[model samples]
Target: MMIFEKVKSAIDMKTVAEGYGLHIDRGGMTLCPFHNEKTPSAKIYGDNFHCFGCGEHHDVIGFTQKLFQLNKPIDFVKKLNTDSGLNIDIEKTPTKTDISEYQKRVNEQKTYREYEKNAWQILCDYLWLMREWKKRIPASPDDDLDGRFVYALHHFDYAE
Candidate 1:
């Protein structure tokens, strides 16, 4: 079944109204949220509501859409799926462009993560090597300093 049909069949208008913080009396009547009113003019039915004061009639989906001021009906469908735990599958088949764009973004993120990982590994190796070279001190003060030790002394701070 389509998402809208399934949702309408699975949910009641009164349940939806109450879920969104509207108070319903024993008669399933509540003050209309669409307009200011002191008396309860809207009557909630099984899958629809009718407002006597403003003449506003809407089904479950329409009521949710209007209640949230959402631009698209599908937005309310998603919200209903989450809030009501309907577990309805609402995804449409992706087009070629959509698949390609998704793959492109995934590839870009993967490439960036790999580069970051490799850079961090290289920096850690260089730092460890510099520390080892620092241990290679000359045997005597007059002895010639090892080139690697000299390089380690100069570049240890930069490597760190």
Candidate 2:
């Protein structure tokens, strides 16, 4: 149960291999650093990882030893846990990257709100201009200035 919790705490799988100076590719897979490898044969799963080339399959502890060439798995695990600052929260929230994405969405929403506000202001200005123009123009018998102003205001209210 302790190992399980430790493994769970070590969420970043790349941290193990990176500690050993091994580079993981963008796909979260890396070439077998245990031996010379022409192509990447390591497969990183959500809970565990395995290297097809060297047949190295273990939990976080096993991974640290093989990757770091250490004699003791426990020492490797402890060192890695401490070095990487493993967060062992039972009820962990999403990472800062997720929060940054949410912030980006909020900024986009604010941009849209500003656009909507500008559009509403333009529409109100256009209505005011039309009312002034109507007053200056000679009114025909059929022209109803009161009715037009009421209709435009009603439309603006509905937009809000």
| Model 1 per-residue lDDT tens digits across residues 69-160 | 88888898889767755545567544556445544544564467569869999999999999999999999999999899999999999988
Positional deviation of residue 6's Cα in model 1 after best superposition, in angstroms: 1.2
Provide TM-scores for the models: 0.55, 0.45
What do the candidate models score in CA lDDT, each in turn?
Answer: 0.80, 0.61
Show the lowest summed lDDT stretch of 10 residues, model 1: 98-107
Off by over 4 Å in 2: 1-4, 87-160
Best by lDDT: 1
